[model samples]
Target: MRHTDLFYLLALQKVEGVGEINAKKLLSHFGTAEAIFAEKSHKLKKIDRIGSLTVERLKDKSVFEKAEAELRFIEKAHIRAIAFTDKDYPEKLRHCPDSPIVLFSNGNIDLTNRRIISIVGTREITAYGRDFCKDLIATLAPLDPVIVSGFAYGVDITAHLAAIENNLQTVAILAHGLNQIYPKMHKKYMSQVMENGGFMTEFWSSSNPIREQFLQRNRIVAGISEATIVIESAEKGGSLVTASMANDYNRDVFAVPGRISDKYSQGCNNLIKTQKANMLTSAADLVYMLNWDLQQPIKPVQKQLFITLEPDEQKVYDFLNSHGKELLDIIALECSVPVFRLSGILLNMELKGVIRPLPGKLFEVI
Candidate 1:
């Protein structure tokens, strides 16, 4: 979109006393943020549910000032903004009732992946949660699906990092600005994710990360994905909240069963007992349950595909998988190919599902 167009949409989103739903309503009513801004309080007051008092209060100069600062911040961060109506915005989100009018993203992943699975669980995760997430992620890495998570500690970060390890794209739904990384321990990993996949959020730069926003962000994570996976959570964990949102959105919800004695397992057990979540033992189970597309075997494994690789890519693939996961730098050195040209080779391998990507610039043979 044009710079002015993005600015206008952000302005409407920044309007005080105006939430996403109402911002969308205003946009639908006026056709554009510019048009909405031109309308007088009296004119807006005539509209049902938009009282004169609300309109007058919305005219505060601070709102525009905040928006202006936000726009500047966007420019500084090189952040991209998307409106619900924009073609790039996720179609699943646009269909939802409480979709945000404007979203802030600082990454490269397409939000509209063919398959998106959101894995959520408790912060005080368990041994089962860790192992289940790693094993399932290893399975999912070969599927070429995008993974969605809140970038929170425990299950969320595990899923994101696992996606990296698998060469799959991941999106971190943030509750705060792109300027700062939360849970500072994940800072380095988040940077890698930003380059490989992306970060997405509805909050503007400088917005405080609050509990309510985190809770609200859960709905988007659930609504945008095709399925939700709860690895481990207490009975009242946020994972349940995400599952509820996914259920309301008619998306599939799956839970990894845990030992009955563990508190973390209670949520998944209860969800299964209540039929709230489909029992998922592995990525294969999820693939079977969702009827996902597995790679159709090449009717004829043409020797031609590997023949033209100039021998270097083959060596890289052979060596990487030979020892399992490897860093790109190591592969480049092993393959004796310039780092610059390694990109095209990696893309080729990724397209064929021959290798998986991992967090922190690591690569593994599939």
Candidate 2:
């Protein structure tokens, strides 16, 4: 966007009563923020939800000064200010109802045709959570997914670091502005993260990392990804808030199950018990559930000369070989194998080059 256009948009954001929804309404009606500011108050009041008070606030000249200052900060910091309408904006997040009108970012971040997933959980991460989180990233590394997180301690940092180690792009969505880093201790990782993926935020340069900001930050972590995975959490925490936001966005949510007695497992277990999230036992479960395998180029289906199959795999392969192509449920039913067990068996068969998975959960023998 042009500097004048961004200046007006930033000013519009500073309008007291013009929130994301209302701002969208105004932008849609007026065509541009500059046009909205140019229009008379009476004309603006004609739009739905544009109350007289909000229209009056549009006249506040002080907002323009703040917007000017923010623009200076953005220029100096070399941040990319992305509007919701931009093609480069997160595609998944653009569909969200309460997505930010503008996003500020810095780094080698790219979301085009990428498989993005958010990993969020307890700030006080445990050993089990750490191991599961690391292994999950390692297993999914082959697919080159973009890992999104809040960039906090524990699970958030764990996910980011794992993605870096795996050489996958990782995004850190912040609770505050780009001018400063939070937790102070995490400053050391800034350069590494920027090189790997980058930082993103909706907050202005003056905003600070505070309580409400974290809650607001949760939505970005959830909305920006194809799925949100909870590595571990207590009965209540910000990670759970992120999971809830992901659910509200109608995106997939996954939770790593742990022993019931573990304190951090309570939230994930509750999410599963309530049918809010899928039980994420391994990376295969995620791949199978999300149909991510279908997006990749399938290997040529030439049967390996001496590949061995487990009995269950043989049953699945025999069914597919005879049936041509069959739905996962049908194979499970005919072979008397549970769907959960059948998925792994089919994956192993695919790896052995004896079978291939089709779209819509269909399977065929090589």
lDDT of 2: 0.89
lDDT of each: 0.79, 0.89
lDDT of predicted model 1: 0.79
Residue 111 alpha-carbon offset, candidate 2, angstroms:
0.2
C-alpha lDDT of residue 149 in model 1? 93
lDDT of 2 by residue, 1-366 (tens): 789989998998899978998899889888999999899988998999888888888988899999999999999989999999889999999999889999999999999989999999999999888988887887777778999998999999999999999999999999999999998999999999999999999999899999999999989999999999999999999999999999999999999888999999999999999999999876667888898867765434565578878888877777787889988778889999876556656666666778777756677887
Candidate 1 per-residue lDDT over residues 1-366, each given as its tens digit: 777777777777766677777777777888888777778877787666777656875675566776778888888888888888899888887888888888888878786545778989988877668877876876566557788999999999888988888888899998887887787888889668987799998887677788888888998898888899999989797889999999999999999888889899999999999999998755545665675633333132333444454476788877886778887678778788765456456655654667655654577876
Worst 10 residues of 2 by lDDT: 295-304
| Sliding window of 10 residues with minimal summed lDDT for model 1 | 293-302
Total clashing residue pairs per candidate? 6, 0
Clashes of 2: 0
Give Cα distance to truth, residue 25, candidate 1, Å: 1.4
